[model samples]
Target: MVKLFNSRSSRPFRIILLVIAAIAAVAACAHADTPPAIVIAPSPFAWSVVVALVVVIIALLGVFLGMVNKSLGKSVQIKATVKKTVEDSYARKIRNEYQAKQALLDKKIEQVRQRFTMVMIKVKNLLDTLDHKELFNAISNLIEVDIGASRYVIFLVDPVKHELYPFRWQGYSDSAVEKFSMSVENAHALTYALKRKQTIYRDAATSDIELRKLLDREPLSNMLVAIPLFGKEKNFGVVHIAAFADGHTEIDESEIRFLSTLPTFIGGALANADIFVQTREELTSAKQVTEHEIAEKRRLQEIFSRYTSAELIESLLRNPEKIDLGGVNKTAAIMFTDIVGFTAFSSRMNPKEVVILMNEYLSRMTEVILDYQGEIDKFIGDAIMARFGVLSDLPYPAKNAVEAACAMMEELELLSSDWANRGLQGFNIRVGIATGEVLAGNIGSSRRQEFTVMGTTVNLASRLETLNKELGTRILVDEATFVQLPRGVKHQKRENVRIRGLDTPVTIYEILEQVKSAKIVSIQPKLDQLASRNNQSTDKDALPDTPPVAGIKRPDN
Candidate 1:
């Protein structure tokens, strides 16, 4: 009972009892019928005790109310804290669910993005190739591996015959591929795709009889996809894919969509290949034409360079019209060279020896003349006639002629020493040069023509060459040639010289040496060595104890 009274439920009853006792006390004090002894005049101490008791009850009630208010506030705080904790836990669960869904969504998006990028890379590779074989191989690998096809064949369209021929194929024998040909008139999948210019998908269980019939001629397959390759201008070809090898009977929507996009790329590749082939053929033809032109130029050069200077041959080749059977009056320097004592030399030898000696002499003289830009006009027996400044204007024709003469003399000296060493007879040569206006061109009939120069200049040059024998000189130039000769040309003036065909005597000069620039310095040591050998041989043969032969003369003598 004490615990009950002290409990919260008993506190309000105690306060109610206290209020009734205070009221009863006050009423008894005011009533007149109450006992006088019991209701004696209330003492101050008694009144004070009653008042203190009331004050104590009021204070206890305030304390109880304060304690009740504090308990209620604590309960509300605990309830609010528990509610907030529950709410936070629920919100965390919801946020975790949202984040997991978002993460899954992000992973799916990333996977799709990667797939798209890979497909784009494959498409780019397909488009970048130009080789037809490589392109077909790439296409086959893509269809078989990436697009999940088991077998495939690429057919090229022949516009002329309106036929489709297997160009590149997989999962088929060479003979089978060779025998595969379909006409556009035929009811086949390739033809159907080509006519429709779209991708056709046919399954074994397809309800459409027409589609089934179109794929009947193809290899035994449960599913067949035919894509027509169309170029910018016309239909190029078609690609047929079969799904029979890997137990795949049907193509999904994504695979079908990917197959649908292959025609554009394949068609573009085919068009580029055609252009490449056509361009290669054109380049080959152009190369052939250029080669023929070069060959003709070389042939002409070989033929013309035999008789004229290389520079003249080049000019004639550049302007082909210049080579005609005609004559032109041009100021030129004419030079003639003849072997000294050739008749006596040949009479002492056989025909073979004579020919060999003449060839050697003439070849040496010809080289020297051409070296100085002089053209070999003709070979008169053991003589050579060359012309300078005939095909083109030369600033120093006289100098060229004199220098050529000097070179020829030097070459002959080397040849003479070489011949002495070889136990062969050697002869001297004479050169004559003259400068004047001459008719230079082709000078024979159409059937047999010769390019030569003719006029007073030619006659004068020949006459001067003949005059060398009498003057005991190697090279003689007429007044016209001497006057034009540059300085540093060593010469001896022979004034007022009479000629066989001239009315009056003409001035001539014997060319002794060439300028330092035109001299052949490299061969000097070789010439000197050969000369020393010849001198030693001669001295050895002329010993004091050896008697001189009566009929035979020394080779040099």
Candidate 2:
């Protein structure tokens, strides 16, 4: 049984060896065209012959072994290649799906950019139009259909209060104004974004409680976005937006980074608008001020034109700095005048005729006022306001006034004759003269202006003039003025006369005139008699002592 098994094994090995031999023969035949390395030219070439046959057999055997190894290597390599190909096919499938999803994401991001661009277009249009109502409505209706967002809220700023009150509220109710008030000093997202001057977006609405409540009843319950509108030192306001219901947004941090440029532009636009509004207001105010000043200047020119010569007024106006507010101790002449029986004479004429006669009287008085370098403060009907030796650039206003008054009296005499000849009632005038320091200048508003004189000296001179009718004299002179008069101005002694608002009565003089025209010299003794009567009346009337009102100029006009 052993022998039989040996025989079967031997036959199979022999058959396999024969198959190997056939493959070796084909390999040897393929290599037959190649040459031997060294020539066998030795006497002992027999060894070379033997080595060549052995080499042939070894080569044939090596080819047989190589064929068997190559077949086994081919089977192993086919199995490895099949396994690698299967793995690569599965990997390619996964890669294709991942690339497809990435492409979709990229497309969605592009769509978002397009939507933002559309909204910006609308924003630009609204800015150009500058119509508030239209701008608000357009902003409220601005849609980003591709991105699946509904509307936006646009706020215009008021930088003065350091608060963002919505100058324009889009896509929201009036109550929304109170809802979104935020302080910039805080560390919240909106405040942070404003401080950094950039756009800020919270991807999830629930991340911020206030935002969740703001859109609680709305569709944008997923996410919220807040963008600051600011540039340089100015902030226009904020723009808030949200996603639509059933929509998803890929709001990356990098997305908002580039939007900083847009807010800058918006802020610039708002700044320009503010400048335009303020400029318009400034122009309007300037025009109003100019018109008012012009009107006031015209009124003043007309008023002062009545009081003094145009050349003199122009001099005063052109050199207002030359006017000294402080009084100067210089030689001057002060004069006062009054009408006699003017009240009784006015009663004789009708109201219109009285006015005409008064105008005529004032016209004649204006001539004397100008000739004496005097200024008229105001008119009290038939009374006149003339000042001399006060605020006169001339050094001798008092003397000029005295001479003019003398000439006025002579002219009045001639006027009286003319009135009598024309069946008109004739009137007489009393004049007083005093000299003292007095303050004078342009008074009242710079626009509505007046030129006048003030001080106690002016009051005393006026009081002296009023005393004339009671003294029954044409002219009077205070003690101070009498001392400076020329030797020819005749006067009589008069006692101190009690004047209103005076602590003590003033001694005065009466001028009898030269039977033509004159100035007062002395009436001081008569003035004292009136004062004695006033002192007695003071005890009876329980009032300060004052002279009887036999002659007093009433300020009716």
Highest lDDT: give the candidate number: 1
TM-score of each: 0.40, 0.37
Q: Which 10-residue window in model 2 sums to the lowest lDDT?
A: 548-557
RMSD of 2: 28.7
**Which predicted model would earn the best TM-score?**
1
How do the residues 1-557 of candidate 1 rate in per-residue lDDT, one tens digit apiece?
88987987566568766776776677566554654565356556665566667767777876787679679879999999999999999999999999998898777556545655666677678677644455566767666666666567777775445677776667778877767777877777778788888788775325677776656675323337778988777687787776546777676554555566677876776665542222222322333324444455555555466776545665655555554437787778999888888888889989998888788888878888877888888888888889998775665576578777887777888898998898888988888898878887777876977778899889999999999889898789876676444433566887688999889777678877543425433444543454445543443434232222221122221
Task: Report RMSD (Å) for each prediction in the order shown.
Answer: 29.8, 28.7
Candidate 2 residue runs with Cα over 4 Å from true position: 1-303, 324-334, 444-449, 515-557
Query: Candidate 2 at residue 412, lDDT?
Result: 75
